[model samples]
Target: MTAIFRTERLTLVFLVLTITAICGLPLLLLFKIGLTAEGSLNIAPLLEALQSRSVLRALWHSLESSALSALFATILGTALALVIGLTNVRAKGLLVFLILLPMMIPPHVTAIAWIQALGPASPVLRWLSIAPELGSDHPLYSREGLVLLLTLQHSPLVFLLVRAALRSFPRELSDAARVSGSGATRMLVKITLPLLSPALMAGFALAFVAALGNFGINALIGIPARYTTLPVLVWRRLASFGPDVLPNVAIISVILALVALVAIVIQTVLQKRMRSALVGLPQAPLDIALGKHRLPVEALLWLFVASVLLLPAASLLATSLVKTYGLDLSLETLTLSNFAEVLWRQSVTLRAFANSTGIATLAALVIAGLSILLGYFLVSRKAGQRLMAGIAGSQAEIAFAVPGLVMSIAFILAFIRPLPIVNISLYGTLWIILIAYVSCFVAVGLKPVVAAFLQMDMSLEDAARVSGAGFGRRIRKIFAPLVAPAAASGGILVFLTAYNEVTVSALLWSTGNETIGTTIFNYEDGGYTTLAAAMSVVVVLATIVIMVAMNALTKKVPAGTIPWRS
Candidate 1:
């Protein structure tokens, strides 16, 4: 009994220390630096930042773009979700996959693709002989352009959340409405929309937060347009001034974090106020008969899919094949030199690929292993165990909720100095980026494992305990096997996200530690647009392949474990 108590106590301590170090400490340091000056309590930095014209302008721009983009995303995503969820849309599976594709693809990659797709040299437009004249200033370099790209980038998130909500909708409401002679349109406005308000609010808040933190669109489009947002402003300050301006940048990051937190809090309150519980079990989504309107609706839906997915993809492929930017695509102008350069000739690109793969893999595996232990405690019967797990989980959720850029700044602030005992500094190394990835993605990796644990039968572990099985033995022989698939799913998600994202690694990446995202971004920013396009094409393909592979595991895992699965 004493041994068992010691084991549990040790586990709790270890989890607390790990969570505090990885998730809590960096954020605490960030706040410390942002809110203090020279080891003393001070608001001067925050006040000075707020009073700067550039900072104020960027803050306003951030709020404006995020709000507009999220509004568009909510309306478009909800309409699409309704069409697919409440109608007899053909190829629903394919449509869902295509809609969700944008979310999986890195935002920078999407920005690059859209830039190429709409540029004066757009291969698709050129082929149709409708291309914009050369030197006709690129249209997507403005505030409107930033919001447009952000909308396209985040609409998929809203779609997925709203779709998931729709799946749980009770059929009784639809039946009740129809039995009262409500027309489809009227029924939708009065009944369906009201019921979906909570989801709509949630989706809107999600999109707002995502757009607010978006560094890719803000940099790629906003920079040229001379319209800056808070994230891009932070990046520019850090890049232009270096760490000499660390205090100022940290203050800016705090502003960004506060904005995100406010949005989340607003969403939470709205959702709570708007939620309407149904008394019946969840049923299949509504299948409203579109009748004669079906053909037109289907055409519109497919056209949207083509516009969002096919156009950019075709443009990206064409640009990659071209020997140089602005070249007309033909056998004469086409070459694979760009791809070859990035994939073979360029040592930097190759190094980045290797570094990202190694770091992301390590982060994923560590998070998965931690999730298993955390999941065990979260599902344990003891109140103390559950409380410890809850605190750890809440901290993780807070870390994940913080913007990636802010998290990057937090990590820089935390680890820029050497450790007290070991006297080793992690700054300017791949180790810092790896730790940041784990911190930023803890919630993501833990979520599915918790779900799996909740669904599991506890009796197996109880039986093993009765038969004299120790904690580790029961976990190893019983719990781990049952939750293995969920762990794998979570690990894959972490890898895909950490592997493709540039935001967290943006300021952290150095010469030899370049990540795939930062490398690609650098290529585009450095006039190597063709190489950027080629690499983005590769990333898109890799992302699709990974998602498909996860789909193959649907039968083994619990229902809803794989997001793309029905």
Candidate 2:
């Protein structure tokens, strides 16, 4: 009995520390940096900056773009979900995979692809004369363009969430509605829409949050348009540090936190209403027939899938091979020189690639291990469950709103000044980068692990204990293998997120500490379009390979062992 209690306590402690490191430390650092010797935090300087007409204009511009994009994306995504979930769409498995492809590729990669496809010298643009005059800038580098790009990148998230809601829908209610002689459109607008209200609201909130916090798209397009969102503004401010730096950062952080909090509250209320509506209804399987309209619906679906997934990718591939962008596309003009220059001619690009992969891999491993242990504690241990639950539940909302650039700035302020006392300088070190990556991404890793843990049967662990198996032994023999796939899934996702991460890395990266993302940014800024494209291709290929390998390994594990299914 004493041994079991000790084991539980140990697990709880581990989880507390992990939460502190990932979530608490950054906020604490923010306060430490902004407060005076008397312990009073100041926001006057930051508020003054915010009061500027230009700053207010920029903020309004960002909010308007984000709101519009979210609204449009929610509608499109809801329509897609309805089509896929209600109708008999053939090759759904293939369609689902294609729909998810855009998410796998980074936003910067998508931007580059768009430029290549729509630029003045491209074959399609040449035919359409969409290219600008000699002194005109490209259309892809504007506020409207940014909205289109972000909408394309983030709409799939809405689709996935709403589709899940549709799948789990109670069909009896719909059947009752149909038997009442209601028209299809009326039933959809009244019954279906009301039923899926929570899902729709959640989708809108997620899209808005993503758009608000987005840095890559803004950096790629908005900067050229002279439009700065909060994340971009924070980055610029941090880069131009003075005595007012800490207060300015604190103000931005508070604004971001408030936005995130509002979204979370709205989501919670809607979700609770949805749950109440769903209570007492037996979940029935859903299969809506297309009833002779399948072909046309499928054609439209395929058009959307192709436009969102294949066009950008194909454009990037074509651009990478061409000797000069905007030149006429000819087989004779294709060369391997761009690839060579990125991979061989530039040592920094190659080194950054390796460094990013290695650091991300390590971070993933650490996150996976920590999350599993934490999940077990939360599920099996009783004493600290409430605390753990509170922390874990809020992790997603907090992480979603905490812009990567802001977190990096908080980290620098927290660590840079205090390191000398510890006889160590952490700034610009790989350890600092790793710490930042892990902290920024741990919430993503935790969600899957916690879900997997909840699905696991307590009986298995109980039996092990009854048979005299020790805590560590039971975990090693039963829990570890069962949860390995889920952990691996989380790890792979984290690795990909960290590897391709540009915003956080851009803030924290220093001389002699470049990541592939930063390297790509540098090449683009230096007007090395071919090299940037080449580097992007390499990163994409490597990411695809890693994803494939992780999926294969995950498949060999048991069905309920994976996070998504669980």
Candidate 3:
């Protein structure tokens, strides 16, 4: 009890308070608001809100779109994983990297880029002489287009998870299957695919939840399509009408939460049903000889990547270089003014860049510092270790599990007022958004750190403590260096996530506190699609550099410390 926490009392207390404030408090607030009207117990308001026509429509739309998107993403992403993970593909590392690039692009940016590439003014479409005729409505303004964008956005996630599963697949079984005179196709169907059920289910669940909570693509594309998902509907209602709609928004949040919960439960049940039944060290992944098919397979893979990734990216680049959205691309029509406007000309854009960078970096550093301590507790033999770990894990999970926009709304309700002692409001200042980012990304920062701790050797830490070093000194001198690599990787994850964030910031930002995500969205909303595209180009290039730099850094860390590294 106290003896166990004596040396790390302050850190322990900080963890408890942070978790309670960020996750527990918001949830308790949601319950209070959603279940109450006029500060009294009442289910009438909640029931009414639930039964409203618009609310029912949104719930159905959310369910239908997310389920379809996850299904499509899983099928496509699993195919890529099978090809890249099981086949003897050339430059597998590079291929996987390119394939996962779409996942790294922020959803709103993806929406903007796709719009730039496919709109009537598309330079490529016009050059190809297939541009849609002017005065006709945009083709993508429908539910199908939203689902398409969501599928593309989430497929990389499925691919990453499935590939990881395949990498550790037991080769012993494959070798046995092969020695039994079984053909490659037959072995794959009878032995391999069945074992992959768990991984496939897990990937689908992740994508499903991701699509359920997605706000960016839905906001930009969904609104135009006149298709309102929960997140977008909440954001629009809250923004247009202000706090008066808080009760209604809270009710919608509850529905979304229930949908997310059901998806998780189903995934868990399905995964538990059929164990792979091979528990020992996983052999190297079984590589089936492509024989004469290797060249065509590689070409087909590249072509898919090119269509999904390259064309839209080129369209984005061309749009950025042009003077307006949908302008035909040509040497004479190209200009750098759009880039200049966002990067150097507009003072507000410059301010936004500075604001988002500073905020994201600050949040990353704070979360990293906290995660380092939290990781210690997760592995330490302290009293109440299980209890503390359970609370810590749940809090982090809930904060990240809910959609960013929903979390933002919860934070708004939680901290819109001034504090008691300082009497200062966090709502309109930079602190509010920074606080939101920390709350939203705590789980992300913890994942790699927890993974690193799971693989750490406790022997060195014991040895250091036996030599009379204090707990603080042991942590600073011994454990910190060992886990620093993973911590750095996790911190970068947080930084990149917070930097490219739009859903959370879209609501939390004020006039002077505009973030990069808010800035890009504002441009798009104001009919400056080219300006938005230029800004997105900057983000995409920066994200690539950051990811590449992160990949290089992970080379020194343990294998599994960086989730994407493997």
Best-performing candidate as measured by lDDT? 1
- TM-scores, each model vs. reference: 0.98, 0.92, 0.96
| Model 2 weakest lDDT span, ten residues long | 557-566
Off by more than 4 A, model 3: 1-5, 37-42
Q: Which is the better candidate, 2 or 3, if ranked by TM-score?
A: 3
Q: Write model 3 residue lDDT over 202-230, tens digit each, in one string.
A: 99999999999998899888898889999
The residue-level lDDT of candidate 1 at 190 comes to 94
Clashing pairs in 3: 121-326
Candidate 3 residue 546 C-alpha distance from true site, Å: 0.6
- The 0-to-1 C-alpha lDDT of every candidate, in the order given, reads 0.91, 0.74, 0.85
lDDT of 1: 0.91
Instruction: Between candidates 1 and 2, name the one with more favorable TM-score.
Output: 1
| Candidate 2, 1-566: lDDT as tens digits | 79976886676666676667666777676755454335676656556757977667767776877888888889888898788767778987667666756666777777777876666655545545665554567787777888898888778878888887876777777788778987668878987888888888889988887787777787778888888777777777776774257566666755655565677688888778775356445464346677788888899999988877666666667677878766555688788899998888778877897789899999999889877777776676465565675575465337545667667777677667546567787777777888888788887777677777788898998899899887788778988787877788888889988998887787778777899888887777677777787888888888777655665655544442322221
lDDT of 1 by residue, 1-566 (tens): 67976886798779878998989989988889888877899988798989999999999999999999999999999999999989997889888888888998999999999999998989989898888898897889988899999999999888888888888988998999999999989988998889899999999999999999999889999999999999999999999999999888999999999999999999999999999987798998888888999999999998998999999999999999999888889989989998999999999999998999999999999999899999999999999899998998888998998889999999988889898999999999999999999999988889989999999988887798789887777778898988999999999999999999999999999989999999999999998999999999988998999998898778877777777777
Cα deviation in Å at residue 88, candidate 1? 0.9
Candidate 2 local accuracy as lDDT? 0.74
